[model samples]
Target: MAVTQQLARVSGAYITRCRASAAVSPDADPEWDPPAEDWIDLDWSPRFLRDACELAGVDSPTLEALNYALNGDASVDVSVLSHPEATGGFGPTPTALTPASVADVAAKLAGLDWDRVMAEIPADCRETIAGGDFSGDPLAYLTTHFMALRDFYVEAAQRGLFVVSWWD
Candidate 1:
């Protein structure tokens, strides 16, 4: 069956389940009444839907169904709210530091013995780091930084250090 059809079927099943689980009025038409907004509000984001699908090991058809349930036919952008906390806890936590405070943090990080960590990076990465090409080839610099951070994380983990989870 097509993914869209499968999704629709799954959605039907979900609605059926919801109706069965709830007390229905005999004279009331369940199909005529849509679910409450709160029902849809709970974990209805595209990313949440995608993650749920992945975790449930749902097939493409089921995933399509899940997507349809969340937001019908429209292509949802999961990256819409990249930093939720930045919007005063509605998203990500806002940065407590001002520009000067951020600069101070950067200066402190710069003073650390990063040379030893950077030495482990491959030769190709060194060129990108040395060039400081933040505008062009940001990925190259990001890759290098990611590796360095990964290495640091591994070392920290080995020592049983607690690392806070943060999405890149």
Candidate 2:
């Protein structure tokens, strides 16, 4: 089976509910299906995006923003991704980011110049990218998903909601 990544903008109340559910039932189901409007289905884009950013020498908050975009800050204690029996193995735990962090990341992403960043990717990195798991134009793929992710963060930040992400 293929593992896809996703993120959701959730209210504080929802986080509390997840925590309560986990505390009351350690064997709770691990399937997390946020409302369609609140979810960002990233497919298999994060790794490619991160690798491209690293190769392009993307710096500081931008790099950090990309990192947090997928690997969220583990602020909550809910084990929403752990279901050994159902999944046959333990997936990554769902992690969250506070509204403030979401805003910070949105700002960083907004500040990035996509074209310049693409041009900055070193030749060796391009070679590595050509040999990567993905086909076609990796930069184009990253651009599409990066825009979606940036928009998602921007909306979440505007709503002052917590963002949760997981791999499963």
Candidate 3:
């Protein structure tokens, strides 16, 4: 139960379970390898964002809020604050993010109290995970990867690009 969330699982090889990529469009074809420059593939997972916000005690417009905007369906014209379409097809198309809708997500992330959030990270993990270095300052390591997610979203928003999250 200690490491029940995705953020807690992130460490060394475990992080590879998830990928966040940025591109000009939704690149659905698996054979089509996106250029390194256009994409930001990370070993980070979605759970990190959610846990980071929760650690700092943030309730309003938390990580769940941002995920809805970025991971939500663009074809459906729903309100920006609405929850993402949880019900969908078997393929990755349902969770794919688009360039046009990024600005709304960026605005939401920009409003977060990053300082307080960063300060909440513990040096040692409270969980009993057997691998990786959650020692000394796990939050320090966690925030490093966590911030990358924030930057990825912001960069995609500025350049009008799209990012998709998935795992094999």
Scored by lDDT, the top model is 2
* Residue 8 lDDT in candidate 3: 11
Give the clashing pairs for model 1.
Answer: 7-65, 84-91, 84-92, 85-91, 85-92, 85-93, 86-92
Per-residue C-alpha lDDT of model 2 across residues 1-168, encoded as one tens digit per residue: 687787889887776675566557757754444578998878888877787778778887689888987888876554554555322343576678888888999889888888887788886676456345667776677788889998999899999988888765
Expressed as tens digits, the lDDT of each residue in 1-168 for candidate 1 is 111110111133433443453336443223322223211122112343244235434456544433433333222221221233211114331112222322332333333333433444454653444334335543344334433433433333333332211121
- Predicted model with the maximum TM-score: 2
Candidates in order have lDDT scores of 0.31, 0.76, 0.45
Clashes of 2: 0
> Cα deviation in Å at residue 87, candidate 1?
13
RMSD of every prediction: 19.7, 2.9, 10.9
Look at candidate 3 and tell me the lDDT of residue 108: 69
Q: Give the range where candidate 2 is weakest over 10 consecutive residues by summed lDDT.
A: 81-90
Error of 2 at 111 (Å): 1.1
Runs in model 3 deviating more than 4 A are 1-30, 69-94, 121-136
